[model samples]
Target chain A: MAKSKTHVSHRQYDDEESGWACMNWFEYMLVVVLASLLLLGALTLTLFWALYYAGGFAWTEEPARQFNLHPVLMVAGFITFSGFSLLLYRICRCCRRIYVKLFHTIFHALAIPCIVVGFIAVLDSHNLADPPIANFYSLHSWMGLVTMGLFALQFVVGFFSFLILLCCEGATAAFRASLVPIHASFGITTFMLAVATCLTGLTEKAFFKLSSKYSEMPEEGIIMNALAMVLVALGILLSYAVRREPFRTQVKTFVTERL
Target chain B: MAKSKTHVSHRQYDDEESGWACMNWFEYMLVVVLASLLLLGALTLTLFWALYYAGGFAWTEEPARQFNLHPVLMVAGFITFSGFSLLLYRICRCCRRIYVKLFHTIFHALAIPCIVVGFIAVLDSHNLADPPIANFYSLHSWMGLVTMGLFALQFVVGFFSFLILLCCEGATAAFRASLVPIHASFGITTFMLAVATCLTGLTEKAFFKLSSKYSEMPEEGIIMNALAMVLVALGILLSYAVRREPFRTQVKTFVTERL
Candidate 1:
């Protein structure tokens, strides 16, 4: 691929310079928007697949639901995220720095399987009645242990990295400007999941009942899993908002320092 | 505090780098090692807790065991995993690359409650007949859905990352050299969970009878559940083994490339 002057970040894509619109800006934006939607849609289908499986079990009156996290693990898992990482790799060539792309690529790859296997061994065979094969009490035992174990590592990494930005590296001004948007984006994602996980637990017992009464349920809680999801969405939004304010200042500093 | 000529990776240390011997290479290693052991030990406890709950319910004098995944989830999920996540922070300094650490962190955090609340919602209040609300069946139904959902995300992330490495990067030597270790680690983890999830599902109907002396039981299946546990262990061993060959090559590479 020829090196293009176009620059696109996670939040926005630049016009004209991006080659995305060298021919036509409107067409380019539409394509980018559609690509984003396509990515999200692919993800949503996986969720629907599980629901479909459950419905198949309940409605079909057979144990047809004994499917492992199959379709995703072998086929989807192998395809989707790995594919995206490549997309990111392409995006990275135009990135301000190699480190950002490298980090993001590595993260997307590692995070997925930790999640896949962790879910399989701990959560795959579970239900509210049996608890996990290990916990079986409050729905909070071994799965929690494993999940948190991995997350714990993430937190430390984040804290230190954040520290580096604040003190060691970013305090130098050049580093500070380049790092904020992504830093916030990742932070927002983290916060989103954190809040989602918490509220998801809170509402789990209520969801089935809530799902049954969806027609009569309050608009606020229309979906069984709505509340937790909302919080997650909010967290992601706030993360963006919080970080957006600093971008101009950051970029200016970055360019000036470079000059 | 001064910038120095010597540098060390997060996982390595030098004796002269620090003042206190107790604070140096061996001690630091020991601290991290001990901490890891504690984390693992807590995991063991969490697993046993779930087992205890579910087993209690079925093994009870009543028609079924007294406990299930709920107890383990609540006791271990809510409490233990969080506590251990904190411990892991101390051990590894948790910072490596964002990929490994954050992947670890996010998984542990989201997974715990997802398992716990998922279990609680499915298991908390139930009668013990047919579908057996508080038993393993319903638990498996609901918990399976949630666990599978999370794994789907993981698989997509991992599979696509691998694809991206292979594709958008143009199969360049640089891409191959840097990503192969990560790709290998993630692949091994994926395979481990794949086998484990499949076996768990396949053996679901026969778990309780794994080791039973029932003359009528199949020869290779004294009790599928007993065998499930064995498979879990073996699956884990294979998980570790998946890395051995690749890791050895990486070690050689590390020596040749960096060390």
Candidate 2:
């Protein structure tokens, strides 16, 4: 039974490879290019909103302005860096699997500092307010905590299971293969959670800062809403990109290699 | 090639059935029970928050109280009913495929009235307010619009393609089969969008209603936050239930029947 299953899979792989040639490269390119733009666009929109409307970044010296860094950096870390990292599998489908894994790790590694600094920026902004506003009280903050925790867990587990286990590739192959779907599913869930957290955060900021002016749809409010829309679009686009089976890596090692 | 592929799938299906018997029913029971509780829990929590804290529901007479119906009914329509409809595939795995489809359709059909009324309640509440609050201006409203639009589209398309096309199943089998994944994917996406929209709406309400008291985490604020958390938990659980391979209907007709 096992031999027959392997033989069938081998045949299916060849068939899928041939089918890939007839597949519309146009659609593939469009998804890749649009995803790339949206990944970068989300960060760009956040930066533009922060600098132009909300006061731009500052450190301990100007805590109110420092609050601006929270959205920008979080978008940079959680949305842009993390999004691009997830997209690497689809975008670099032709690349060697190890190289793709390295790039994935490298991109997520870059996001950690942004997340750390972003976390501190918000904390300082809240703590150093003249009135010293309480932290972690809002729904946004609670969701952010969950998103960050999941991100950290996914990073640690993924790094250990996929990369560290490679030291005993033959012995660990079955164990690692079993982990792939769980990792992939949770990775997408984490991304969705991050997007949800950002949406709530945007809503909180709009109401807090804009107050009555928000209903009138001021320039800054519109910018922030547009930025929110971009993030929503990213959530839809990224989910589709990742879930679409044809876009999936065709090789059998996908079970263990192309996480 | 086609004959070989069908033979392989037949054998695989039998193998999977045996594997299913050996599979831990405990985990399946846990997931089903937890999902059902969370689905009902989400609606119950929303109702508790609405009635106890938000001043309960009304129609056009008391616009402020009428607004409370928005959250409760939305949770019922979007999360509870839609959730159960989605879960029917997993929950009734042993039932006839046509029966499962009918139940799926029936549940979603029930959600439509709730969604329609929930939408109207909010609009009337906004427009009839003493100072006629503006509509569709906030990020929450915008997200809600997109979610509703997608939900409507998914319902119409699913009903037509899956059910209506069955009248000519032999001719439409391939077309209906192609739509299953798309319908399933978008169905989950719409659910996720609804959850995200609810989170944003909850944040908006927390800041608006709780005002200065929100920072202190008052009882009402906590209730709302707790409701938001339930929705978040639902998002994770439902996504896992739908995406998990073992929970999927282990039948050949999944392509054209189980959906």
Candidate 3:
């Protein structure tokens, strides 16, 4: 009876694995394709909103127009670049683990300048205004601060632990393996925080700029709202992609590569 | 050689399990206490904001004051009750699975009235206003609608699959088991959406009611911002607790219970 029970359990495991395998290809492709589209679409919509509705962007020449760079660049940095970086893990499951890690790091590194300039554009816009707007006073600014801080921390920790520690690979293997989940969790949290901050920022902008017109649902209002919805949709899709166990790469290389 | 390799891997597993067991109690207690406090603290702060700052609540008699009920009750329903319900799975790991499920269902059921009344309070406040404010126009309102829709869908699906299908436990066991992760993932997503909705709503309110005073960081603005921080902290802590593998229960009963 005990032998039969063991056999039954082993078969059950096989059945579950096979079930996951069958659905894996289509679902994987769907998530990758949809996520790619939404990431790029969010950036495109923001650019459109900034250019078409909110005058174009400028540096110190026009602070009002300079403020427009804040949203567009933030969406590009936080949503587009950071998002693709996070998705690289699942998207490049067939690639060498080192190649995937390099791409992830590269993508995030590319986001750094965009975020820094985006931060500066807003501050410059506010300070350069005739009657300077108060900086970091609103909830949106506060949330953005938190998100940026988290992003910086994740980048530093990931760089040190995942890449730098690889020099002493044998000794640090277990440590790196343990940090993977922690790094991944915080990465996703940072992304979600960015999404929330953007939404609040958009709300503030709509109310501040559109004023009573926001309630009237002007073209700009609808466009901004659509942009917000895309962010929301991206939040849902990315989280689902990251959390679903069946989508996780099951390659033996994953264990050997320890990433 | 084969037997030795198998023994080595088995011992590694044992070591990992034992390591988790050592840290489990302290970490578990910390998460439970912290989560409980934040969950209640959020609701309390919102009450203070509504009552002290926003002039408290009323029904249709006083439309403006009645709007106060919307934030307070929404926090109670969406953040407090729904939060505790989600945490019960991890918190009551030693309890019978059936009891935990019953409690989860009961807590969510209690939230139903709070949400419904909260929804109506805002609607009445808008419609009964002297100027008759528009409904579902702002990004906040749109986000709220999405949240409420998701909440309702989750309730129906959870009730039907987890509770009603118990009548044929043997035949439906595999089906129910598969639904567990999906249900769990969506539950967390719904909670996060609720948090995002609340943050956007708070931003809208601060801008709409507080107006220019909000930037000066008045007492009410500080209070509302504090409340937002608490919600953000809860989001981080709850997600960590749920996702941490070491914190997950590993009892033999877990498999037998299939929760």
Candidate 4:
């Protein structure tokens, strides 16, 4: 909209290109490296943390083992899936708009069950404790629930606005224009809330399980911290991927002319 | 800027006027209300949490008393001051650019000492304990330090780019234009990091002190949770305030034409 017209300088085009522009060798490699690192780091650390400390996953027979699934699923679902969703438009910029939308929606849809199951696993763990621990007591849980609610709300709004309403004759261009930015902003906000929840949850677990040993920086604690950093990096990269263009309409001309 | 040159639809002009346009009565009132709520919530909750739970501020006589200053200063410095700095442009949009810059810089400068003192208070409490607690061990501590470092880096960069270098003939127009977006992004990132740090620290403290009582949701636990919620709300509101417009250039034109 208004951004499409703005021109700070030739440098504005360069600045936009640096992140949002077509692929160059260095920029392409940087994206690949960042995406790979985020994917690999989230996978390896979640598995390591789960298997080594939380005792891996299991079925109904082992409730404690079910508890292990929470962090793993959290990393995979909340961080990894959410991150990939943020990267979807960037990764598939050449794809049809419908294709990108489908992929984005599917990715987030897959994430939902993982998170739901993860929440259930944690709740189950608490319930199965000798003297059943309380559920939703901590700030982590509060924030987690809020993020999930917002995510679901965002999903519904997006689904209606982009998918369903687009097919209907009544959907106005004005509405879509306004909704897109808010949708994107909420997308990042939800991802960040997820990251914050994970960080706090990790810290809580570290202290609860390690007690005095946490102060010593035990292996699990180190792994958890490393995972946290990876999540932070992913968050930053995701922001880079999804942040709105400062100059949109002119940017299109610049990109067209340059290409 | 190219923004001043391009024309979108009349609707875009309207949209730009809605938020990024001039300060309309409703929008102005909304910002004022949000800022007031954020400041009041942060201050009141921090004080309530500290006084009711941590036993308000004190000096050398009791290290625990000294520890009370940490949360107070964190809310005041990291959240409140940082937030106001983000809002400075909007708050003083009618003022000259130099006046806005001066106010922003001074606010941030004031925040630095608050954060520094807060950090020292926590360190002092750890050292002065009966059996000195370890320093910089927890993820909270690590992330908090990292955020502080980023904030400091951001301050120095901003100081040089905006205040010092602006006066020098060598500070090219292109350089200043590029610096603005990055500076704004980092400001928000640093603030989010601070909020995350505060959440984790609060959770850690609640559990450490309350233990099982926390599960039952003691008055202190409730207060801490309230404080945490306020922080989250403040973060959300800050995001609404400072997020970079995707259509900045077009926005300027739309605003100019509409007004």
Best by TM-score: 3
Best candidate according to DockQ: 3
Candidate 1 lDDT at B86 equals: 29
Candidate 4 chain B worst ten-residue window by lDDT? B250-259
Off by over 4 Å in 4: A1-32, A244-259, B1-28, B169-171, B244-259
- Per-candidate chain B TM: 0.32, 0.89, 0.91, 0.84
Per candidate, the number of residue pairs that clash is 85, 0, 0, 16
Q: How far is candidate 3 from the true structure (C-alpha RMSD, Å)?
A: 3.7
Winning candidate number (lDDT): 3
Candidate 1: Cα lDDT at B116: 50
Model with the higher DockQ, candidate 2 or 3: 3
Worst lDDT 10-window in candidate 3 chain A: A247-256
Which of candidates 3 and 4 is the stronger one according to DockQ?
Answer: 3
Pairs with steric clashes in candidate 2: none
Tens-digit lDDT track for model 3 on B90-173? Answer: 567778788888899999998999999999999999999999999987988888888889899999999998889999988888
TM-score of each: 0.32, 0.91, 0.92, 0.86
lDDT per residue as tens, model 1, B9-94: 42244443444344444644654455345434444543563464235334223433333443334334422343343233223333
Across A171-214, the per-residue lDDT of candidate 1 in tens digits comes to 55544443443343333233323332333232432333344333
Cα lDDT tens digits, model 2, A1-259, are 3445687897887777668666746666887899889989999989998888877879999999999999999999999999999988545667888888889899999999999999999999989999999988888998898889989999999999899988988888877876777787788888999999999999998988899999999988898899888888889888877776556534334544554
Two-chain DockQ for each candidate model: 0.03, 0.59, 0.63, 0.48
**Model 2 lDDT per residue over B33-145, tens place:** 99999999999989888888878888999999999999888999999999999887655667878888889999999999999999999999999999999998899999998
Better of 1 and 2 by TM-score: 2
Considering TM-score, where higher is better, how would the candidates rank from best to worst? 3, 2, 4, 1
